[model samples]
Target: MSVDVSKIVRSHEGKRGKLISLLQDIQSRYNYLPREALEVVAEQTGIPLVDIYGVATFYRSFSLTPRGSHLVSVCLGTACHVRGGREVAEELERQLQIKPGQTTTDNEFTLETVNCLGACALGPIVVLDGRYFSKVSPARVKQIIKSARAGKEEHTADGHVFPVKVSCPRCNHSLMDFSHQIDGHSSVRMTMAFGGKHGWLRLSSLYGSFNLESEYDIPLDTVVNLFCPHCHAELISANVCPLCGAPMVPMLVIGGGMVQICARRGCKEHRLDLNGVNV
Candidate 1:
């Protein structure tokens, strides 16, 4: 059946929140929101094309390009950071031989990262084909990548889900931990800033794929962090609360990386590594 791109915008009745919902529906139906579909959305909503593109590109979960049958999303959120989220992002880039926004040549996978998935307790989260993987590590990255490439449908009980690696070429860092904290009171910007974390880079041109590990680390600072882990008076300084020891998780993250992914439908929150965060 032909997908109705226009209906997505029409359903919103020119509402603001619907823009996100509209984009989500469009992506769900088409796997990726086609440029043509976006243009249609702009026309229907009476919104400028630049504005629509900005909206689409603003969120980390939205994908402008088509995705593979199997999609791979590695979380670089805070909890995952201390657990090696950077290594995970880099290794996926290496394994796919493509940057975060680009897809593999074989059309088998797409790699992207997000600042915080609210699974801090499950830091170093990896979402494959929309399925959640919590508490991932550099050592576990390879196997996840392998299994993802091989299309394995399951994981071992020892906290191994899909195989993705996390080895850093500089100083043998091999990131084993990650952290997703906003330190400040404003919404964290996770987009590419002129001199911030998500800006353009000469990653491939400067340090060829074969030598990426030997090259320098790209300076990237997130520009659009908007989620609040919890809505309590003492929301700050918590993967889990210091006072009540309750978990504050993500309801959803609008945008940060290359794609616009939400938490799974059933769980509402992505999977996290309880053991990893405790350690």
Candidate 2:
């Protein structure tokens, strides 16, 4: 599909700090930013091409090259490394027939290594398509690959779901609403606006869960703008949703790293980046 770069640029016209958002939209449409689209963005927005490239390369989330359908990330942090993270990664390479930072021949999977995933207790972690697998053994690599190829979710170790404590990325203030709990954990509270209606939204603190309580019954596919309850800064990020082409609302994971969720109601696209890890 040909990208209408002009239309995307026009949508963000006169918006401050829109370059990141514009690039995100283009990447979301094409799976990666194409050179032609970058030129078009520069021409239409009057932003220099060099500056555009700088922004594209600066963020680890932005990929200049085309990415495969499924992203496979292995964590090799200090804790994971001692726990045989390298062996797990080597097993993945052996199974997928590709090394780190390389996609499979069929463009089905891209393998990458990250420093950490903030789940130290669960070392030897492997994240496939946003799902976490902890304490992965080299022996399980083949099954994981097969499951991913078949589009089936492999159960995490012990079927455990991790809870995350997040805060406002802007003010560094805790966004955890202890008084309002979801999934038996403190909810991440934020104010939002959608379809001209403003309301409070509380999201489940669980990483893999998508349960959220909102003041309004937001219609499906309604893209909302989220703001921090304490700092009032917009929670918008430069990244776009992988599943839906909508802006991602970002929050700081209490320990270290960031968690972003799709702003479009009913879209469960979310990502967890830890210690500069991008997957």
> Each model's TM-score?
0.51, 0.73
In the order shown, the candidates' Cα RMSDs to the true structure are 16.5, 4.8
Give me the displacement of residue 174 in model 1, in angstroms.
Answer: 35
Q: State the C-alpha lDDT per candidate.
A: 0.47, 0.79
Assess candidate 2 and give its lDDT. Answer: 0.79
Clash pairs, candidate 2, are: none
Give the residue spans of candidate 2 off by over 4 A.
1-3, 156-160, 163-189, 194-202, 211-224, 228-279
User: What are the per-residue Cα lDDT tens digits for candidate 2 across 123-183?
Assistant: 8898776678888999998999999899888765333366777887556689999898898
Off by over 4 Å in 1: 1-3, 14-17, 77-79, 157-279
